[model samples]
Target: MVVGARRVTRLLDAVQLGMVVLVLVAPVAWMVLSAFKPRTEVAALPPRLVFTPTLENFAELFQRTDFLENTVNSLIVAGGSTALGLLLAFPAAFAMSWHRMTWPATATLFARMAPGTLFLLPWLMMFTALGLVGSHLALILTHAVITLPVAIWVLLPYFDALPREIIESAEIDGCRQHQTLLRVALPMVAPGVVVAAILCFVFSWNYFLFALVLSGFDSKTAIVASFNFIGEGVTNWGALMAAATVIALPPLILTLIIQRRLVGGLSAGAVKG
Candidate 1:
C-alpha cells in the first residue's frame, strides 16, 4: 500500500510539473516555430508543425526594417536604466532591510503598481516643456521607473539575510553605511545583485507602453519597432514572430547563463523576506 501511494505521489508530481512546463513553454515554442514558417503556414488553421522552414521572415525583418539601429537603442536604454536603477536601489534596499523599514518600501511598491499611463501625460508635458522630448536621456530616466522597484525588492531580502553581528562589527570598526555596503554587504550579496540586474534589464528592455508614447524615431527600441509588423487591417505574423524571437534572445540568454544564481536569490528572498 505504501509503495502504491508513493508511486501515485510521484505520478501526480510529474503531471503537475509537466502542466506547468506546457503552460509556460507552449506560446514560446509556437512563436519560435512560427518564426521559421512562411506567412501562409503561420496563419494556417491547424498550424503547420511539419512544414518546411524558411528564412524569409528573418530576411525581411532585416531587409525592410531598421532593426539593428533599434537594437542599439534598446541596448542603450535598457543598460542605462538598469545601471541607474541598481545604483539608486542598492543603497535604498540596504537601508530599508537593515533598519526593517516597511513604509518606504511600500511606497516604492505603490509607485510601481500605479499604471504607467497615470504618469504618461505628466511625463510628456514635463519633458516637452524641458525640451528633453525624444532624447535617450528621457527614455533612460523614465525606464528607471520600471527597473528601480524590481532592483530594490529583489535585493531587499538579500540585505535582510545578512548577519547582524557582521554589520555591528563593521560599524564598530568605523565603517560607514556606504562603506559597509560597498566593501562588505554588497560583495556578499553579489548573487542577489546579478539577479536584480537580470530582472531590471529584462523588464526595462521589453517595456512597451512608455516607449510607445515617449520615444521618437531616433530613440525607438526594437520592441517598439516590432509593432510596425502590425497594421490596422493586416498583420505580419511571420515577421512579427521573427522579430520577437530576436528580441527575446538576449534576455533569455542572460537568464540561462545565470539561472542558478537567479534561482538561489529568489528562493532565499522568499524564505528570508
Candidate 2:
C-alpha cells in the first residue's frame, strides 16, 4: 500500500509539472504558429493547426510600416535605460544592501510595485511643461524609472552577500566610498550586474505604456508600433502575431544565451542572508 501511494504521488507530480509547462508554452506556441499562418487562417473559426506557412505577413509588416526604424528605437531606448539605470542603481544598492539599510530598499520596492499608469498623468504634465515631450530623452528617462528599481532589487542581495572582510579591507586601504564601489565591489558583483542589465533591457524593451504615451513618430518603439494592427473595425491577427514574434526575439534570445549566468546569479543571491 505504501509503495502504491508513493507511485501515485510521483505520477501526480509529473502530471502537475506537465500542466504548468503547457500553460506557459501554449500562448508562445500559438503566437509563433499564428505568425506563420496566412491572414485567413489566423482567424479561422476552428483554429487550423497545420496550415502552409508564408512570409507575406513579415513582408507586409515591413512594407506597410517603419519596422526597421521602430526596431532601432527599441534598441536605443532599452539600451540607454539599462545603462543609465545601472549607473544610478549601483551606488544606491550598495548603500542599502551592504549597510543592511532596509528602509531605502523598501522605498525602491514600493516604487517598483506601483502601477506604471499611476505615474503617467503626472509625467505627461511635467514633461509637457518642460517641453520635453516626444523626445528620446523623455522615453529613456521614463524607462529608467522602471529599470532602475529593478536593478537595485536584483543587485541588493548580491551586494549583501559579498565578503565583509573584502569591504573592510578596501576601507582600511583608505578607499573612498566611490573608489571602493568602482575598484572592489562592482567587480565582485559583475555577474549580478549582467543579470540585472539583461532583465532591465527586457523590461524596457517590452514596456508599452510609457512608449505609447510619450513617443512620437520618430521615437516609437516596436512594441507600440505592434498596436497598429488592431483597428476599430478590423484587426490583423497574422500581422500582429508576426510583429509580436519579431519583437519577442531579442529578449528571448538574450535570455536563452545568458540563461546560465542568469540562473547562477539568482541562485547565488538566494543563499545570501
Per-residue CA lDDT of model 1 for 1-273, tens digit only, reads: 999999999999999999999999999999999999987889998877798889999998888888888999999999999999999999999988888999987888798888999999999999999988878889999999989999998888789889989989999999987899899898999988988998999999989998898889899999988875564322778888999999999989988977887788668768976
Q: Model 2's lDDT to the true fold? A: 0.89
Clashes of 1: 0
Error of 1 at 42 (Å): 3.5
Q: Which ten residues in a row have the lowest lDDT in candidate 2?
A: 227-236
Error of 1 at 167 (Å): 3.4
Q: In candidate 1, how many Å is residue 229 off? A: 2.1
Runs in model 2 deviating more than 4 A are 174-176, 232-234, 257-273
How far off is residue 125 in model 1, in Å? 0.4
User: Which residue pairs show backbone clashes in model 2?
Assistant: none
What overall lDDT goes with each candidate model?
0.90, 0.89
Pairs with steric clashes in candidate 1? none
TM-scores, one per candidate = 0.86, 0.87
